[model samples]
Structures are given as structure tokens and as C-alpha cells.
Target: MSILGVDYGAKKIGIAKADPTGGPAVPLTTLIVANQKEGIERLQQLIASEGVELLVVGVPVSLSQSGAELLRDKDHLNKQMQEVLQFVERLKNTVTIPVELEDERLSTKLANGMQKELVKINGDDAVAAMVILQSYLDRKKL
Candidate 1:
């Protein structure tokens, strides 16, 4: 199965792809859009072009507290996550393929760490999608 992972954001969307054979998820491209409509359009084009059979979207949820700062940010984070779910709902409506939301806590941070360790590449939203997709793929293997 061809799976596409998406990291959704207000201004940009990150894309990554992997196959059922358990290959490494690769970062595709970042779509920058003015709004949700434009984002959906671009995403549809990507799904068509990439032959995606399933879509995995990253959802930021407050599942852990590593420090005191998290308590302060919890309310704001919850509100932001609600907006993300709204965007995910709209995206699901635009595609016929099955779409699933995976917990994406610390995906960006992990991507940043990976980028720093691997040198020679700049950081972008796509890296975060890679992290999300790879996590999903790994879980499926078990």
C-alpha cells in the first residue's frame, strides 16, 4: 500500500510517503497556502500524483508534560489542537481514501534533532511529516 503522511499547519502542510513493504518514509514537499481551500486543492493534487492509498495526518495533542512550561501552555495548546482537528475534518472530506490522525507530539522536535545529526540539509515541515509517517509505519510492523 502506498501511504502518504501529512503534517498540517495554518500556513503550510508537510508531506511524506512510504510503502507497505516497510521502506523508509521520505519527505516529499511542503505546500504553502493562504487558506484551507487552497491547501486541500494542493493536497488533492499531491495524492493523485503520488498514488496515495492512505493518508496519515499528524495531530498535535497534549498527552505529556515534560516541564512546568507545559502547564502554562496547556490551555493555548488545546485550543490550537481544536483548530487542527477542524482542518483535518475538511481534508478528510476532500479525499476518498481512508485518512487517520496519529499523535504527533514532539515530531517537529525529533525532526529537528534528526536534521542536526544528519547534516547537509535544511529543516522544513516535510521532515516533520517524515517523522510522523515513519512512526506510523513502525507501529504497523508490530
Candidate 2:
């Protein structure tokens, strides 16, 4: 089944796609939406057009110093994390396909590093989505 990776943000949402047979994910595009409604609507269209079967959204989670334990204190969640959770909730409520969350601790940083090496990078958001999706694909192999 084809999979779509999403690096969602308030204004810009990064997108990436993986083949049905499981392969490396590639940068797709960045959706610049004014609001969540617009973003979801565009994502629905993309999902239909791309024939995506699964949707994986990158979620930011706080980890302890040891990086073994997850920090789930709602009160301690940063604004961005809270917003992402809200976005994920709305996405889950709207989408027909199964939605899964993948840890995206340093996806953007990795993407930025990649951007410096590549001459033709498809925006930071798209690259970040690629990073998120690629990480998911790699983990599935192990």
C-alpha cells in the first residue's frame, strides 16, 4: 500500500510519498494553507489523487534525558506540540484512511542539513516530510 508522510505545521504542511512495495520516501510538496480547514481539504484532494493508502503524520514528543521514556505531561507541552496534536486530531476525524503518528524529534534539523548539501532542494517543509517518511520506512525494516 502506498504511504503518505506529513510534516504538519500551522502555515506550511510538508508532504512526501512512498511506493506501495515499500521504498525510500521522496519529497512531494508543501501546502501553504491559511487555516486547518484549508489544509485538510487540500490533503483530501492529494490523498485521492495520489491513491495513498496510509497516512503517517510526524508528531513531536518530549523525551527524557535518557531518551527512553516519553514525557506525556499535558501541562508541559509546548505550544507547537499542542497545536500539532490538535491538528492530528482534526486530521483523524476527517480522513478516511488510517492515520498514524511517528516521532519527529529532529526531522526539521535533519532536513536542513540535507538542504545544505543538495543544490535543488524542494523547500524545507517537503524535505522535512521526506526525512519523517524515510525514518518511518527505515524503522519498519528493523
Candidate 3:
């Protein structure tokens, strides 16, 4: 089954896709939306066209210094995390496919590092999505 990864944001969302048989995820594109509603609409179209069977969304979580546990309380999530959770909820409600959340702590920093090597790169959001998706794929192997 093909899997799609998403790096969600208020304005721009990063997209990545993995092969049906399971392999490295590749950066797809960044969707620039005016609002969450528009983003979901665009995602619906992309999901249908790509024949995505699963949706993986990256959720930013505040981590402790040791990175052993989450730092934020469940009842008091940060603003960004709250927004992402809301978006995920909306996504789950709108799509028929299963939705999964992956912790994306330093995915953006990693993507930015990758940008330094490439002369021309798409938005960092797409790269971040690739990072998130790749991390999920790697963990599944273990």
C-alpha cells in the first residue's frame, strides 16, 4: 500500500510518498493553502490521484532535554501542537484511510541541512515530510 506523509503547517504543508512495497520516501510537493479547509480539499484530491492507502502526519512535540519523554502536559499542549492535533482530527474525520501521527522533532532541521547540499531544492516542507516519512518507515522495519 502506498503511504503519504504530511508535514503540516498553517500556510504550507509538505508532502511525501512511499512506494507500495516499502522503500525510501521521496519528497513530493508543498501545498500552499489559504486555510485548513483548503488544505484538506487539496489533500483529498492528491490522495485520490496518488491512490494513497495510509496517511502519516508529523506532529511536533516538545521533548525533554534527554529526549526520553515528552515535556508538555497532555492537557496543556503548545499552541502549534494544539493546532496540529486539531488538523489531524479534522483529517481523520474527512478521510476514509487510516491516519497516523509521527513525532517530528528535528525533521525540519535535518531538511534544512539537506538543502545546503542541493543547488535547487523544493520547499523545505517537502523535505521535512520526506524526513518524517523515512523515519516512520525505518521504525517499521525495526
Candidate 4:
């Protein structure tokens, strides 16, 4: 059994994975989809091919008043959160595996500050998914 992590977005969806042994998470690939249909199809294929038993989806939450800085605006952040939850629900309907959400507040920023070579190869979205997945794995161990 393996676990897959997703950093879902409007334009691009990031992906990462880790073994069931609670090993290090690795950036997989970014899905550049034109619409939700394409995104879901690609995600399904990846999950099947990777033998992912669980799906860890990033759910952005802001404790500070600034909110998700990537979103820039509070209203936009709220709107995006709704869309993300809806997408997650749709994803759950399509897959039999257990789906979970992880807090991804600073994942994108953290990913941006990662190794330059990694960023070049995986892109920010995939790296962000890695960060989100690794966090979950770490918490699971403790």
C-alpha cells in the first residue's frame, strides 16, 4: 500500500507519494488540466498506476488574519476553499480509497524555498504536495 498527496488548484494540480512504511515523500508530477473533468481523469490514472491506497489532499486554512497569502484576497480564499472541498467530494465519489485532508497553510511557500534543482524538475505544485504529504507522514509516526 502507498499514499498519494495532492495540492489541488484551479489551473494545476500537484502530486506526491510515499510508501506505506512511512518513508520519505517524493514529488511525482504536476497535472496541467484545462478543467475539472481532465483533472479527475488524470488523478485517477495516477492513483491506479502508483498503487495509492490513500489520498491526502491539502486543505488550506488560515489562523492569521492575512489568510492564504498565495490567494492574496480573503474573499478569493474563501471561494477557493469552497471549490476545493467540492472537488474533494467529487474525488471521493470516484475513488474507493480513503481520502484525508491536511493543513497546507505554508506548503507552497515552503516548496518555493526548497532546493533549486528540485524546483526545476518538479515544479512548485508537486513540491508543495510533497511538503503536505511529508507533514502528514511525520504526524502519523508520532
Winner of 1 and 2 under TM-score:
2
Local error of candidate 3 at residue 26 (angstroms): 0.2
Q: TM-scores for all candidates?
A: 0.82, 0.86, 0.87, 0.87
Model 3 per-residue lDDT tens digits across residues 1-142: 5799999999999999998585789899999999999999999999999999988888887444333354335457888987887898899899999887788989999898885543146678998998989987887761
* Model 2 per-residue lDDT tens digits across residues 83-108: 88778779889999988777887999
Compared with the true structure, model 4 gives a TM-score of 0.87
Candidate 1 clash pair list: none
Better of 1 and 3 by TM-score: 3
Clashing pairs in 4: none
lDDT of 3 at 133: 91
Question: What TM-score does structure 1 among the candidates reach?
Answer: 0.82
In the predicted model 2, the residue pairs found to clash are: none
Model 4 lDDT per residue over 29-78, tens place:
99999977788889899888988899988888743322235334435557
Candidate 1 per-residue lDDT, tens place, 1-142, comes to: 5898888888988888898676798888888899988988998888888888999888776333232343345456666676677777788788999887677889888887785633225345888998999988886771
Q: What stretches of model 3 exceed 4 Å from their correct place? A: 62-74, 115-119
| Sort order, lDDT high to low | 4, 3, 2, 1
* Top of the candidates by lDDT: 4
